[model samples]
Target: MKSWLWLLVGLWPAFASGNDEAAELLKRVRAQHSADVVVSRYEIEIVRTEWQRTVIMAVTEDQRGGRYQGMVIAPRRLADTLYLKRDGRLWMVIPRLRRKVGISPAMLSEPWMGSDLSNQDILQGDAVIDDYQHRVIARDGDLVTIESTPLPGRPALWRRLRQQVRRDAVPVRVDYFDQDDVLQRRIEFSEVGEVGERRLPMVWRIVPMPEKGEYTLLKVSGVEFDPTLPDDAFNALEQATAGTATSP
Candidate 1:
C-alpha cells in the first residue's frame, strides 16, 4: 500500500506543479491555435543599392506550430518566386520554369537578399522544442523570461535562445546565440495584438551579429488572419500570364 501511495504522489506533480505548469501552458498555447493561423500580404522594399526595387510577398505564419510559406513577386522581372514549406520540406518555385527546386541544408547559412538574414534564420522559429530546453527564469512587469538551452541534437549551430513571454504568456522576443555562446541575433516583436483572439507579433527586427554591421527588419503590415487565399493563387501559370515571369 505504501508503494501504491508513493506512485500516486509522484504522478500528482506531473499533472500539477511548477516546471510542469509552464510546460503545460506552452502545450496549451500551441494546441489551441493549431488550426488557426495568421496570413498577411506585405510590400518588401530592400534598399541595398542606388536602384531601390520593390517586391510583393504573401506570407503565412502559425503560432507555436510548423509551416511557413512566402511568395515573393518581383515587379516587371523574370519570374515570380515561391518559397513553400510542405511536410517539413522547403522548396523554391520559379514561374518561368514551373519547377520547384529543393533548398539544401547547406544554403541555410547563405545570406538572404544580401542581408544578415538567412533562409535558415526565417525557418528557425519553428520547432522550438527541437532547438531549446526551456526553463522559466523570471517575471518582470507582466513579462516572463524563459531561458532556453540549445539541445545537443540540434542540427544547426546555435548556442542558446531566450524567449520573452507577455504577462498573459505569449512569446514576444526571441534571442539567438552562436556555437561559441556569443550573442548572434536578437528578434524584437512590436505592435503585438490579437489576430482572431490569439496574440501575435506584427513587426519583427533581426539585429546584427557582433562585428556584423547593419541588420534586417521585417515589418508585417496589413495583417489579416484566415483569409480567402485560394490555392490557385500559388499557380505558376498565373504568374506567367501576369507578365511577372518568363518561360523556364
Candidate 2:
C-alpha cells in the first residue's frame, strides 16, 4: 500500500504538468485567433457526392469565439440570409419571410450550408478551453499533440478532439472523434500568413471520415480584430428579425 501510494504521488506532477501545459498552449492559440471582436469574410467551397458549390459569407464574432452573427453574401437564393449564434444557441432570420427560427440539436449537428462543418463547428472554437478537459499527450520537438475530452454538461457533441499545434500556438491539424472514438472528420490548416499581428491559417480544409474524395475548403479572405464595434451593433439584425425594427 505504501509503495502504491508513493507511485501514485510521483505520477501526479507529470499529470498536472500535462494539464497545465495544455491549458497554457490552448490559451495562447486562442489569444492569437481571438480578439475583442473579429470581423471576417470568407469563401467556402463544398464538394460532395451529390453537390458542389461556393458560398461567400461575412461574420462578426465576440472574443470568446462562441458568439457570432453571420450573413450570406452571395448566391442569390441564400443571399441576405442571416444567422446568429449566442449563448450556445442558434437562430436564423429570413428577410423575405420576416421571421426567425430557432436552431438546436438537429439543425446544429447537420452540415452547415451543405459543408462538412456543422453549425457547432463554426461557432464553438473556444469551447476547447471553456468546456473541455484536455492534456498534452505527446510532444515532438516544436510540434505538440493534445487530446481534449468534452466536459460534462457541455453542449458539444464531439467525444474527443486530437489537435496538433506548434509551440507558438498556431494549429496544424485537428481530428474530431465520435463517442466510439471513431474518427468523424479532420480539419487541416495550411497556407499560413499574417492576419494583422497574428499568423493564421489562410486556408482550412476539412475532410469527413471513412476517407473518400469528398471535402470542404474554407478560404479566409479578410480578418480584422476590431474591438470598436458597439455592443448594440447586432440589435438591428435582431429587431429586424422580429419585424420590430425601429427607425433611428
Candidate 3:
C-alpha cells in the first residue's frame, strides 16, 4: 500500500505539467487574433423566423489600449450610429439626436441593436485570456477543447465558457454558459482565409439560448491589419461630429 501511495505522488507532477502546457497553448491561440491595429468592414444580419434585417458597419480596433470603435454606414436610417470603447469605458452616439450616451456596466449584457451579440462581446476582445482560468478538457485529432472559469472577483457575464481550437491556432467554436451551468449560446467560426499575416475566420454564426429559431451572422467583407489608424479613430465624439461614412 505504501508503494502505491508513493507512485501516485510521483505521477502528480506530470499532471501539473500538462495543465501548464494547456494554458500556454491557449495563450498562443489567442495571440493569433491579436493585432497592433485592425480595421475591417462587417456585415451583420439578424435573422428571425419571419423577418431579417441587415446592417453594415466599419470597425476599428486598437489592441494596445484595448479600444474598439464602430460606425454604422448603411440602411440609411441607422446611418452614423457609433459604438466606442476605450480603456474599459463604452459609449453610444446617435447622429440624428446628436447625443452621446455613456453605457452603464449593467447594460453590457444587452443585445446590440437587437442582434445576438452583446455590447460586452464587441468591447471585450480576447478577455478570456486574462479574466478566466483555463484548462484542457479534451482533445480530438488536431483540435483541443478547453473549459474556462472566471477568476475570483472577475466581472464576467457568463459563468463559464468552452472553446475549441485547432492545432494551427484557429478558434473553431465557443460555448457560453450561465451560473447554473446551463448553456446560453454558441458561436461557430468558419471561412478560414488569409487576413494580413494570419489566417482567421471571416464568418461568425451566433445562436442564442433555448435553441430559438433566430440567429445572427457576421461576415467580414474587408480587413487591414497594423494600418496607420488615426489617433482619434476611437473617439466617439470626434467620429459623431465628423458625420463621414466609411466604406470598405
- Tens digit of lDDT per residue, candidate 2, span 1-248? 10101111111112223388877777666566655677878888999888889998887776444456788887888887887766655677776876677765666677778888776555454333455677889999999998877667865567888888889877788888888999988888899888767877778888999779899898888877764777686774556445432221
How does model 1 fare in lDDT?
A: 0.53
Selected candidate, larger lDDT, 1 vs 2: 2
Provide the RMSD of all predictions against the true structure, rounded to 1 decimal: 10.5, 9.7, 10.8
* Clashing pairs in model 1, backbone N/Cα/C closer than 3 A: 79-245, 96-248
Each prediction's whole-model lDDT (CA): 0.53, 0.68, 0.68
The C-alpha stretches of model 3 lying farther than 4 A from their native spots are 1-18, 126-128, 230-248
Question: Model 1: per-residue lDDT, tens digit, 40-120?
Answer: 665544444345445567666443244456667557563357766544545667666676666677777777555556655
The candidate that wins on TM-score is: 3
Give the TM-scores of the predictions, in the order they appear.
0.70, 0.82, 0.83
Count of clashing residue pairs in every prediction: 2, 0, 0
The candidate, 2 or 3, that scores higher on TM-score is 3
- Per-residue lDDT of 182 in model 3: 98
Cα shift from native, residue 166, model 2 (Å): 0.7
